[model samples]
Target: MSNIEIVDSNISTNSEKSCVFDSSINIDEISYNDFFSNYLIANKPCIIQSNATKNWPCKKDWIQNGAPNFTLLKQLFGDCTVPVADCNKRFYNSQDKDEMTINDYLNYWMDFRAQNYPTDSPLLYLKDWHCKKEHPKMSIYQVPKYFASDWLNEYYSGRTNLNDDYMFVYIGPKGSWTPFHADVFSSYSWSANIHGRKRWLIFPPGEENHLRDSFGKLNYDVLEDERIKNDNKSVKFYDIIQETGEIIFVPSGWHHQVWNLEDTISINHNWVNGCNINNMWLALKNELLSVMREIEDCKEMEDWSSHCQLMLKASHGMNYAQFYDFLSFIAEKRINSLVYKTPNLSFDTWIFGKNHNLFDLRQIKIILENFVEDAKDKSIYNLICKNDEVEMLLNKIELVFQSCK
Candidate 1:
């Protein structure tokens, strides 16, 4: 029903005048190829009109009278325990959160509503509740085609061994806010407001450096920092208001803080695809390197590099072994789609033509090669390539590329 112009995957958008957009681009129509080239691959952020989300089940089930229908949420999820954060206190990089049932959290919100949302009490905000994971049967929201090429969710979802996903449901009241931070692994994220409104201050890639203090530490709350007053010219930040039923795309490496302008319920996801797979790989490399630096003195110990990988996995939920497997998993899927065509993935790959599929394979092959090279650094060849599958998958992807050529 939507007219999606198939963009030539190799054609650069900068050369196409109609494909370029100003910061004020408001897309009332959802074009998969154009959205992929203009925003996703371009790494720019934009707000798609609410018409994009008009048919989502959340627009009907989650909203009531222009606000969240808390009573219905409790009835659906009261027994499930959720994480609640106190906005008044900041813990290290993120606010400390405690687990409570959905019912209790809703009661706290209702009590706040009864009190006219006074500032005196600590704001209890429910953040990052995996309601979709727990209630997969419930048709809450659909992953828009614009974000359907999500490797993070696809990988985690396919693994029965893993019990996590990037999909999250956020519910909070007015004044409840998130601290300044980038998405996990610097992945691109899109958030859709199911109900209520949100005020967001998003800083581009380098503006966060201007907000850092003399200690070289990034400020947790940019709003409370005094350097903000003196350093206006150096920082380029966008203060945008997200309305109910609208979706906002936050690109990779963009640090942002969000405040609820009213009681809000939203669906959010951090996703990785061919366009930003390199960013994820680099983020993992840097995170692992930081961990290795912390324990550099342990090099004298037996299997010191192995210990670093262990700590990396424990802290970041991923290490070189798993990261390799992630790439391989996606590589195999593209291989199957392009080579065998047995396991149907038409829902995601339908809009993506042969060139787009080849692009995915190319991205995965580069990362796999990097993984093998990086593993050889510490003579950890057994960590990846010696396993044989990485090499086989790389060659298989190359075969696909050659066939395309």
Candidate 2:
């Protein structure tokens, strides 16, 4: 565990406050429009005021007095099994993960508490729980208006092809830390701390390029790596103390590490929208190319391209087809909105009004052009040609995009 101490408001001085909260933006400092134009569009990270999640129900249901409501949590969700990561040990690139019931996790947490919070390594942190999937009717928190333009969840939740969403709940005790990494698919993510403080070290987008060592391997822990600090003096980051109720808007490609300064619970959502869809496509292309290189000896193997896609999906949790489906899904919705002169009824994701819909459509068009060129270069051009619906969708998207312009 890192040696950073939690900033106590009563005991902390102005210097300590500046060190921890230099990156914070008061919630009232910016309206939703300012948030969209400044943070989301600019692809930057910021700690919004706790007021963003101040009114959330989880503050009441999940937190009792000043501590986590462990009793109620175990009562309602003890049966739900979640993957817990051992922070002290690394299994190659990531920590060792095991599945356990929420009940058992809560018990382990309580036992850790009873010991008076020892300086222990290897804290067990429950990483990602799709509790919304388990309890669909519960209202833990409403999505903040600034982040309501969440295309990723909107697509995953309504998909008939799969039952999944990126909404997640994270719970962990003090000293539990997550290693540095970018978000899945390089998408934007927002994490709201319902209770307890968190220490976050977030590096900007291209900082990752400097993080890799001579062997082209990234360090598992940025804080502990001497070479990373010595050799890459230019790499900068934001050290933020996210107090309880604060929501952090993490933009695409910003690699970050987080530690629970106390027993903590947070709601997180990984989302993609027109703003960062290009990053998503580029990530897929780069990952696919890397996978191809890994299995280059199998170039003569049957369906080698298909095998590469399968491996990509297995490793990255998504393939080009699924990504294309995501594009097509949003494209259809935006196209329908424009063609029928109808506003997007899904209020949570529709931003900037109808003209913003046009911008999204145009953004998709730009990516679609790159998608085709990449397919042809990869020798999988037939993947696009074989799908009649994809071709027609492309045509319709182009027409709508032009007409709207």
Candidate 3:
């Protein structure tokens, strides 16, 4: 068992400390290439200031009088069971999580708020709700152009095994928060505050070592961790107060914690593109290694490798086989699009232009090639290569790239 800490959610004393971070580069608009070069590839966080999500119906329907419309939420999603996090309770290094219907949660929230959200019973925070699929008719928000090439959501959307996606809706009372952690798969993420304000504590990669305990778990309260501020004082951090309607870009591998400065609702997405696909691949490999180590004592057991692979899939949401499946699916589509010269049917062609565009077929082929080369460096690639479909797809990817050349 790990050390569990019961924290008071409403501590605002940390605001008195001096915190310095580069004011997020505010831009009215950005191009795909510029974003890729300066931020995605560079792995730098920024904030894009624009009225990009003003048209989202939730902005008006889900909020009233500068706070979440609790009555509306109960009316709309009363029976919908949601994953709620207890913000004031820590289970190891993360918040204790539970599930309750929107109605039940709102009922509890109403009672809690009326009693001023007591330190016990935990602050119920509805995190990662799949609002888009549940209410497809509701015109929410559009994904920004800079972070548009999202393979995770694009591939998963076609499969029913996981209808949920990187797109998420987070609703919580004031003081509800997420603990410090990096985005899964080392992927980049962006959060657009739909309403209310959030205080974000973002630390660039490499500095997380200062905060993680010997067990490799990050501290729950990043802002108030004295071990980080007084002991290993070299770690610098960004304290950002994200306002409603503003989108905050969290670069690949940046560890962050978020607190609802007021009753808040936000839409967030975790994404991977050619710019950070390598990082995603690396993260997957690390996950596999960790899975292997966990079950190493059973290595001599029958089908141990297969068991490890199974655990990898269950733990990380995908295994090497699924990775190959995703790669093959995208590569085959792109190859067919190139072979048929169908620009309209080709996402790469539309976004990157026919040739030498922002993300052309040829550029995609190169990324696939790089990924394949990197995958080959992994020991598990041998098992992946043993699959007939994987071999065929690799050959097809090569043929398509050569033909384009």
Q: How much lDDT does each candidate structure score?
A: 0.80, 0.79, 0.71
Off by over 4 Å in 3: 1-27, 227-233, 341-352, 355-382
Model 1 C-alpha lDDT per residue in residues 1-405, reported as the tens digit of each score: 222233564544232323222334455565687788778778788887777778888789767877667788778898999989999888997898898899898888999999999989979889888878898788877677788778898888888589898889898989999999999988999999878899888887788998777999888889777555454655777778998878999988889999999988888999998888888899888888899889988788998878988999988878888998888888777777667664435323434456566677777777888888887786777854565778887777778877767
**How well is each residue in 1-405 modelled by candidate 2, as lDDT tens digits?**
111111221221112111122367887766665666567667777787887787778887888888888899989999989989988779987899999999999998998888876766458999888998778788778777777767888888779468888999999998888998999999999998998889887887677777787998777888776644464557777777998888888888988888899888999999988778888999999999999999999899999999999999999989988888889888888788778865564433333356557667777877888888888898887864576566677799879867865
Q: For every model shown, what is its TM-score relative to the native structure?
A: 0.92, 0.89, 0.84
Candidate 3 per-residue lDDT over residues 288-311, each given as its tens digit: 899989988998898777788899
Which parts of model 2 have CA positions greater than 4 angstroms off? 1-22, 119-122, 227-233, 341-352, 402-405
Clashing pairs in 1: none
Q: List ranges where model 1 is wrong by over 4 Å.
A: 1-6, 9-30, 227-231, 343-352
Q: Which 10 consecutive positions of candidate 2 have the poorest summed lDDT?
A: 9-18
In model 1, where is the ten-residue run with the lowest total lDDT? 13-22
TM-score leaderboard ranking: 1, 2, 3
Clashing pairs in 3: none
lDDT of 2: 0.79
